[model samples]
Target: MNYEIIINSIASIGVILSVIFLAYQIKKNTQASRANYYDSLNKTNMEFLRQLVENRELGELLEKATSNWDNLNEDDKRTSNYLFIQLFRHWENMFYQHKLSVLDKQLWTNHLNTMIGYFHHDGTQEWWLKRKMAFAKDFRDFLEKTEKPKQIYPTIKDLTIKNK
Candidate 1:
């Protein structure tokens, strides 16, 4: 009887230790997953920014398209369309990530503010009206419901004028 009780206690302690170890591993994995996801998102954003930095013509086109889409020539308009598509697709991905709790709330809020700032431009709004359907319905609905700022965010042109 004494031997049986000693074995049962040992088994119980081993089971508890295994459960604790499993919980720790699960937590470690979750942290790693979140870190990996954030890193990927940052890399994607950097790639976009790098393109704008490395290609002066593309940067200029983006500025013009965001500020004056109607004034662009047919070819410029097509290029601008593709640019906006890529930009909005990235935003849509961020939106879904936030919805899935993969993205941090504060980070999502910052991104949302930037998105709203972009939308404050009439040209961006016009582009969205035409191309919004290309995105997922949920993302479209989220953007449609977002409140744009009353004042437009400063563009490169606006900054140039301010400097002068």
Candidate 2:
């Protein structure tokens, strides 16, 4: 009887330890996954910036499109349309990531502010109105409901100008 009781107690302890170990592993895996996601997101952002920096014509087109879409010729308008599509697609991905808790709240807030800043421009708003259906319904609804920031943000052209 004594031996049987000791065996049962040990088995229960073993089960508890296994449960603790499993929980720790799950937490670690989640952290690793989140890190990987952040890294990938950063890489994508860098690639976009790199493209703009490396291609002068592309950079100028983006500046013009954001500042005055109506001024662009037909071919430039088509190109700018595709550029906005890519930009919005990244924003949509960020939205879903934040919704899923994969992205940090502070980071999402910063990105949201940047998005709102873009919307402050007439050209950006125009592009969104025409292509909003290409994104997720929830994302579209969220953007539509968000109030534009009271302070106007600078455009790409403003940022590119030399201070001197």
Candidate 3:
């Protein structure tokens, strides 16, 4: 009977240890998956920035539209609107992901601050104010609540001026 009791105790201990080990492994795997998700988002963001950097025409359109929308002709306005739609669509995805808790809080907040800076730029506010209906309602509400920061990012013109 004593031997049986010892055997049972050992088996119970073994089972408990196995459970703990599995839990630890699961935790590590979850962390790794989250890291991978963040990396993927970073890559997508970098690709968009790369397109802005490498393609001067796109940069010029964005620059002209954002800073001087009042001066663009009808064709330029349409083109600029198209360009901004492409840019902001990706941003919309990021915003939703953050809202769903897929993105880390601090990372999303930093991105949000950057967006506030963009909103404060010359013509961006006007553009968004008119085009706000195209985005998700919650996102539109978020933008409404966000106070535009005093400082804006350097315009695309500034970055591309060296190339010219």
Q: Would you give me the overall lDDT of model 2?
A: 0.86
Q: Evaluate candidate 3 by giving its C-alpha RMSD to the native, one decimal.
A: 3.4
Give lDDT tens digits, candidate 1, residues 38-125: 9988998898889989999998898888887888899999999998998898899998889889899998888888888887687888
Tens digit of per-residue lDDT, candidate 2, span 1-164: 99999999999999999999999999999999999999988898898889989998988888788877877899999999988888888999999999899999998888889888886687777677778899899989988888877875676567667453
Clash number for candidate 3:
0
What do the candidate models score in CA lDDT, each in turn? 0.88, 0.86, 0.80
Q: Model 3, which residues run further than 4 Å from truth?
A: 1-8, 156-164
Top model number, TM-score = 2
- Worst lDDT run of 10 residues, candidate 2, spans 155-164
| Best first by lDDT, ranked | 1, 2, 3
Quote model 1's TM-score.
0.92
Candidate 3 C-alpha lDDT tens digits along 1-164: 99999999999999999999999999999788879988987897888778868987776777888886777888888988887787678678878888778789999888887777776676777788778799999877887787766566767566677678
Clashes of each: 0, 0, 0
TM-score of each: 0.92, 0.92, 0.77
